[model samples]
Target: MKLSGLKSVENAHDDSIWACAWVPATENRPALLLTGSLDESVRLWRADGLEPFLPSPSTGHCLGVVSVAAHPSGAVAASASLDSFVRVFDVDSNATIGTLEAPPSEVWGMQFDPKGAMLAVAGGSSGAVKLWDTSTFELLATLPVTPPNQQDQQPPPRPASKGSTPGGKFALSVAWSADGRRLACGSMDGTIAVFDVARGKLLHQLDGHFMPVRSLVYSPMDSRVLFSASDDAHVHIYDAEGKSLVGAMAGHASWVLSVDASPDGGAVATGSSDRTVKLWDIKMRAAVQTMGTHGDPVWGVAFRPPGGAGVRAGRLASVSDDRSISLYDYS
Candidate 1:
């Protein structure tokens, strides 16, 4: 696979653009790119021009937008901010569908289930994954990612502390498996927790990094494989089920802030404080292409979802602290 720069929108937002997602295409329109920024607003962009599709910006998000996710159906999308609010709104009409908040539990990463039945959010500092039913707009559960090495579970000297507690975990990012049976979350302390969706229990803890893992994406083609980008400036691949470290690829000069896998699952893309976006070949475990288009730290990168009529070409989008967004044609 190869990536060629297609378009760049300088100062796309007034502040750092921290999140991005590709809203699925609909019968009336092709897929569109959605981005949220530290500027406290979310903007939509078509694949062609970097123009804002909506005449006015969607406001109401206090503080800064931390993450964005589009529902599978393409009718709605959601954005989470540091304020702990998950705002769900229509993709086209831009109407507020619903807003969810698990107070005392700040929000981080979020993704809708493949079937669009539930929305799983990474509970910041809550040390758990919060699930919300799409229809009821009610929280289903807060599945905690408890570490197994608890001292209390053992006899005598017990584990020093229940570092496994959700608060101790300080969850940062989350990703669901292709089949939707498993969920994995990354923490600020560099621990990864894998859980069974049905059983709602912690399965394993995968270890490889020493810094905060800010972004994670499970391979769309392989449910067992997972990719993570961390502040340590490395991208680590893991076998989520086996809890084994598959590989670690490092090149960025600064923190790797965000990562996403291609729909075909052959490659992965990452944004970093190094102010560059790097495309890595998963099988070869190496960086094949590097694009230095942003002068500031890149915060988010998203590959367009594979769908939409007559849309055969591939696209990758990245947003940076330079307050700009860049698009690439991937082939």
Candidate 2:
């Protein structure tokens, strides 16, 4: 498989685009590309031509929008900002569905449950993953990423303490398993905490890189497998349940910022501080192709969810600090 540049938009955002997700298609519309930027706005684009879905950028966030997540049903989505608030809104109308806040904590990355029942946010400094009920938008639970001994302890009280928790696991990015039974969150110290979602407990910790792990994702076709990108400049694949490092792909010259598994489960794509995007073949554990289309560090890369009528071919999208968005044909 290879990636061919199809379309790229210069100045897609006024500032850095930090997050991207493919919103699945509803009965009335095809899937759309959702992006959040340091410009403090969230934008949606047509998957085919990169046309703006909204007349103007959707605004409400402050301190720049850092993360965006689409519900499985495609009717609603969520965006989080550095200001510590998550705005859940209707996809079509941009109507505010709900606003979520966990006092004294910052939001970094977010993902909706596979069944669209819950939304998980990586709670920075709170050292936990916060889950909210999607239906009622109520706070469901907080899964702390502390060590086994401190697992039962609550995160530092409302006004968070200055020092780090015993584990020092400041949650940065989060991903849910395909079966929805497991969840994983990456931390600043490069530790990955896997949790049993149903019990809201940390299952085990995976360690490899020494720097921050900024992004992670469970294989779309395998619940036991997980991939993580880190400031150490390597992408590590893990057998989450086994608590073992299966393999680590090293190629990026700088920090690997983001990673996503292809829908077919055969390959994974990564964006890096090296100003390049790479496609790594899982079976070979090596990069098959690299695209240096962005002039600045690439921040996010995502594969379009497989479903929508007449959309059989694969597509990948990447956003960067250069304020551009690029789409590629993945086949």
**In candidate 1, which residue ranges exceed 4 Å CA deviation?**
148-167
Per-residue alpha-carbon lDDT of candidate 2 for residues 126-153, written as tens digits (9 for 90 to 100): 7889999998989899888777696566
Cα RMSD for predicted model 2: 3.1
lDDT of 2: 0.89
- Tens digits of lDDT, candidate 1, 53-121: 899778868878888999999999999986779999998999999999766445888999888889999
Question: What TM-score do all the candidates reach, one by one?
Answer: 0.93, 0.94
The regions of model 2 sitting more than 4 angstroms off are 150-167
Most accurate candidate by lDDT:
2
Error of 1 at 111 (Å): 0.9
Q: Candidate 2 has which clashing residue pairs, if any?
A: none
Of candidate 1, the 10-residue stretch with the lowest lDDT total is: 156-165
Question: Each candidate: what lDDT?
Answer: 0.86, 0.89
